[model samples]
Target: MIDLFKFFGKEESKSKDIAKERLKLVLIHDRANISPKFLDMIKDDIIKVISNYMEIEEAGLDIRLSRIPQEDDTYSTALVANIPIRRVKNMGPNRG
Candidate 1:
């Protein structure tokens, strides 16, 4: 089975991928200067607001702050949210 899987192609090592993800999260939090509790609060609020407009895949929602480098070597923090929408709400006059 391992040989068969390798026959198709080999992917990045899981451990390395995990390490990279952990480093990214540490950097994001450090640059954003936010605590885990605060992050959770923000995530919850986002879910609430978005769910009001559309059905969302809450379990798959990914919210993070990323540092983007600028031309002058300065960095800007960006709010990155990946929310999968299932369907839009039909609120008629009050639709979002």
Candidate 2:
């Protein structure tokens, strides 16, 4: 008779993989409180409003809604926008 207890190793790697997958999901949600759909809505609105004031390349704007973990619980959500400024026709170099 042969002992069949030394054929395969224990399942240690599988546990780590599962834990990593779960952490990724939780971090994604925590960073963005609102769903992906809602974040899209906000980005659109911000670009629209900003366009009215200046000549903004709407397609090039990047407005992301994220959360920041801090000591106190006052302000958690932060809105970050990346807008590139292009010199308009009239707003050229300063001339006399």
Candidate 3:
């Protein structure tokens, strides 16, 4: 059988892509005058809130700020979150 992982791409190459994304995120944050620590705090808050309703793979979580190009040739910073949810939590009755 063919190696599917290799056919698509390897983990090592994925890491490089991740690194590039991170660099882009940093640049975006800087341009938007946002601090890295502030981003971390926001990420933590998101995880805490979402955890109440879902079982997520925190290790695979990727949160960053990105620039969305506007029609006027400008850009707006946006909060981008790529959270890997393993499953939804079974909250009883009123979703406690």
Top TM-score hit: 1
Q: Answer with 1 or 3, whichever has the higher lDDT.
A: 3
| Count of backbone collisions in candidate 1 | 0
Candidate that beats the other on TM-score, 1 or 3, i.e. the better one: 1
Give candidate 3 misplaced runs (Cα > 4 Å): 1-23
Better of 2 and 3 by lDDT: 3
lDDT of 1 at 59: 82
Superposed Cα RMSD, model 3: 5.7
Looking at model 2, residue 5 earns an lDDT score of 54
Q: Count backbone clashes in candidate 2.
A: 0
TM-score: model 2 vs. ground truth: 0.48
Consecutive 10-residue window with the lowest summed lDDT within model 2: 2-11
- Weakest 10 consecutive residues, lDDT, candidate 1? 6-15
Model 1 stretches astray by more than 4 angstroms: 1-12, 94-96
Tens digit of lDDT per residue, candidate 3, span 23-62? 9887898998989999999999999999989999999999
Residue pairs with colliding backbones in model 1 are: none
Clashes of each: 0, 0, 0
